[model samples]
Target: MTSNFRHVALIGKYQASSAGSTGDSSRQALEDIAHFLERQGCEVALEAETASNAGLTHDYPSLNVDEIGARCDLGLVVGGDGTMLGIGRRLARFGTPLIGINQGRLGFITDIPFDTYQATLSPMLKGAYEEDLRPLMHATVVRDERIVFEALAMNDVVVNRGATSGMVELRVEVGGRLVANQRADGLIIASPTGSTAYSLSAGGPMLHPSIPGWVLVPIAPHTLSNRPIVLSDATEVAVEVVSGRDVSANFDMQSLASLLHGDRILVKRSEHCVRFLHPQGWNYFATLRKKLRWNEGGS
Candidate 1:
């Protein structure tokens, strides 16, 4: 959905994702992004809760996710990559596009750095930035075939051991047929856009953002025969915790309370898609090169 620019919403880590010095640094980045977006001709909007913790003292404060999504054209999400995933899920329905500014380590999704905002995002606000459309996955964690928690993940939906070190035994099925049962750390159901995130960490191969493919990658599978499998966007995948050696999930780390043992995760291509604004002439591999230091030196 292309449109002329009007309202822009900003979301960030007001509290902390980790601990200690990392938390302090995240708070600072949140503040900087707010000021930067304001200077970029976009009024800042945030949850009342987020604003207070970030020491945000703006007279013209903003609204929360629901209100901002309804009114904003773009959401400028700041923080680590996790922050962008939260914003994307919270405001997924508004058809609102997002631009992420990376503030922490290993920001695979939030590819843009704070320093490059003006060079890449300015033209975007003026309706000049290019757009990349990626498919999102809708997941339902069920028990007894009854829906428990329904959520959206731009990356992968993982079912793995929680605190235990043992392999999480899972039974995978596609279109109601059994795929395999093996022991592993976890299983990753990832979108192409998410291939570089935890899925990659779990040994999944990197995929082009343009390709509409989903990957089933097992984390350190006990059997060598259990390899990463690619499926079309049309295939629906069902996974049940046949035998949970204490397993849990993290939906982009938004809410950990919902993930528990005996939970079943049903993943399929979602009707919703997230639009990303890239600078003119932005290339996927080129961005990866600079961000991942593909050919760069050991600094």
Candidate 2:
């Protein structure tokens, strides 16, 4: 551990390859950005699968996400918010700081826009910015006392009805106590880092970035009683689907889609944290104001 790093990993969206012409455009951005970093005197390592998507024969270094995070001072993620989730989860493993350049709209996670690539990245290479510590959530989607799909998220973990109109029922528990028998399209448990994301879309409250609490929001609940609830770090929360003929849960809304029945989901504050490299004088609330469109005395 060098207290900071020099080698960096660059991650992008492989799923977005089907985004019509936008896919080709996204792929090109990755190519241009990697070359940009190399020119900046940074050793850039890209995800192996990304090479395949680019139709390039070059091999990515044999490195897992954790290894990349451990070895690299930073992880630069290109593409949409989904790309941020993919790399953010892995970066949590070794507590690596990430710099996201948004190539997508709103770009809650991908805060820095592509147009500011040079301006935003130049200071980072020269070690000239502050690290905003962002919390991460660890989720385990399990069944029969066995781990099925385990992951960490800077945003949220979703347990939803995949490709089905019927709701997915779940009994919510906090610290081993029953909270609610949820009847909804799905459930979202998000960190403050994720509060602006799916949780916000699902009628969850907005949490300040440094709030140090977790938000549990039900997606499309059948009853109005179920509102998004925030919990402290010490609490242990579990969600178990009551019963279903065809049940599925999506972690992070998209990826880790369609899990099976009898699954018990566990969510907790991860021991690890994610540090983001922000432009100097970064203001979390000010950024939120711009993204959320909080007008003066208006909607």
Candidate 3:
């Protein structure tokens, strides 16, 4: 038990992928979670879309993302990591802490399972949980020294070619020093929290979440000599589109911005960090072992 959370908000994925079509299980889980929190003597609010998806009655209150951020003591995300990503990025600016209840595949960031909700959510609501602060990246695309596009990404910021089967060149600089002139499909600048995401799939090393560094992984580089590099959190990275080809800068593989020649995308650590509340006995390594099947030893 750490901090008492009195006001809790609920958010989840809109679509469910089970049982042909009814999606009764997923919808019931949301209703039960809401009622459970209310019974625990905590005020609960649901995000507008989540309320709509769950078919909540008019008696239940609903708040938009901004309202939830401004008021709720904690937010409970009731879906997969993607749902958390969307909510976390939005709430990060308000410094709101979030807890995730797994209802989708992978559930990497959504640590709690639907089956364990009865046992986990109650104790966790009573202040039995671990709080983890994860740093996010604030990325901006600057064309001619003026900011053109900006967004926050909880995972990795990707600069890749768009809609064509060809390689693009990117000139990478960190803290004003040239790091590489990469000829590749793209470059992924990922926070440590994103190490196991797109970066890992592109052959980047897995970074522990506590690491105060960012990884730069080149995607399908023309030369094998070009490899992934980790930079200190303090370092400011700038990537220029040197190949004169149109490239896209992606935030958490969601929001996108198009880049042309002379466009430079800047990536740096965000001032605000997202806080995750995990249930007691939640182990990161154990989660990795289960999700990734590390112990099965099948290379």
Give the alpha carbon lDDT tens digit for every residue of 1-299 in model 3: 22277888988786653344445676687788888888778788888887776677374789999999999999999988888999999999999999998865557789888877878877877778888899999999999989999999989999998666589999999999998789999999998778889999999998888899999999999999998888898989999998846688999987999998889999999998999988888778877887887884532
Off by over 4 Å in 1: 1-4, 16-41, 104-106, 257-263, 296-299
**Could you give me the TM-score of model 3 versus the true structure?**
0.93
lDDT of 1 by residue, 121-173 (tens): 76777788788887788888887768878888888788777665677788898
C-alpha root-mean-square deviation, each candidate: 3.9, 3.9, 2.8
Model 1's number of clashes is 0
| Candidate 2 lDDT, 43-75, residue by residue in tens | 777766665565432634534576786687788
Instruction: Tell me the TM-score of each prediction against the true structure.
Output: 0.85, 0.84, 0.93
Candidates sorted by TM-score, descending order?
3, 1, 2
* Clashing pairs in model 3, backbone N/Cα/C closer than 3 A: none
Which predicted model would earn the best TM-score?
3
Which 10-residue window in model 3 sums to the lowest lDDT? 14-23
- Identify the leading candidate in terms of lDDT: 3
Model 2 poorest ten-residue lDDT run:
54-63
Q: lDDT score, residue 12, model 3?
A: 75
